[model samples]
Target: MTGPAAIRAALPHRYPMLLVDRILTVSADEIRSVKAVTLNEPWYARLGEEPSKADFAYPDFLLLESWTQTAGLLATRSEEEPADGRTMLFGSMRDVEFHRRVFPGDVLEHHVRLQRAVNDTLVFEGSSRIGDEPVLTIGTVTVAFRPREQLDPEHAGRNSAPLTGSQRGEKS
Candidate 1:
């Protein structure tokens, strides 16, 4: 079992973006994780005053992202730590489906299986549920190990010092 701290160490995500709340089980072939949804989520705030019915529903894209992040952890568990200045990124996803709406009180249970791993790319198949009700399904998902420098040209090379928000042209 992996708690929030361990999950934080294993994943680069944080705060409102860090979707997975806990990892119940993980092995070479499969993984199970959880995400506790609540009204405190940033998306809920984005709905503004007197939100509509659609605003109460969790966004489908974020549901997919949460599942993909869970798969990413499973995919990288067996591999050596990524080399300096490198990170794993979502490559692609296919046949993703949403079976039902997920609400603020729902606890998303994610189940992911290792479909295959070839070189730097890993493939997975997974689904999510809230209790006995199915919420999402993914036929196949792939993630790639990539160099930060290549992914962001502004980052310079492997040995380059990290840049601050202002240096990157963002408000501090």
Candidate 2:
């Protein structure tokens, strides 16, 4: 079981944004991770007293983000380049579907598989589950690693045109 310190070292996400809790297992092509959800999360703070059960349900987008973060960790673990001064940019997500609503106290277990990799672009497919029941499934997700300087508007010359997804190392 890998702890938060290792996860933190591999991912750039910080508090309130770092969604993955711990890594259960990781290999060259696959990774299994988990995230424990709780009522104390910031997403639930906005609700009023005695909010409906539906109101307490975790946001779907956040669930996806957590799963993606797990995938990022796998990419970092397998890649040779250091993550320093580089940012992982989400290029695109396709065919994502939610099967069940997740609430506080549910532990989300994610299993992700590396589908393809070329240069700095990575493609992944995965699913999330709570216990034995499936919660979410991702068909394909593409992410790219880019030097931080390339993302800075100030550094990208004022007159220079913005780089397309291909130029940014994203697979079209």
Per-residue lDDT tens digits of candidate 2, residues 1-172?
8999999988879989999999999999999999999999999889997799899899998999999999999988767788777788988999999999999999999999999999999999999999999999999999888987778745656765787888878997
Every model's Cα RMSD, please? 5.4, 4.5
Backbone clashes in model 1, listed as residue pairs: none
Q: After superposition, how far is residue 89 of candidate 2 from its true place, in Å?
A: 0.8
Q: Write the per-residue lDDT of candidate 1 for residues 41-103, one digit (tens) a residue.
A: 988877877887777999998898799889877967856665358778787789988999888
Per-prediction TM-score: 0.84, 0.87
- Give the poorly placed runs of model 1, Cα more than 4 Å off: 80-84, 153-172
Candidate 2, which segments miss by more than 4 Å at Cα?
153-172
Model 1, position 60: C-alpha lDDT score = 90
Determine which window of 10 residues in candidate 1 has minimal summed lDDT.
75-84
Candidate 2 lDDT score relative to the true structure: 0.92
Clashes of each: 0, 0
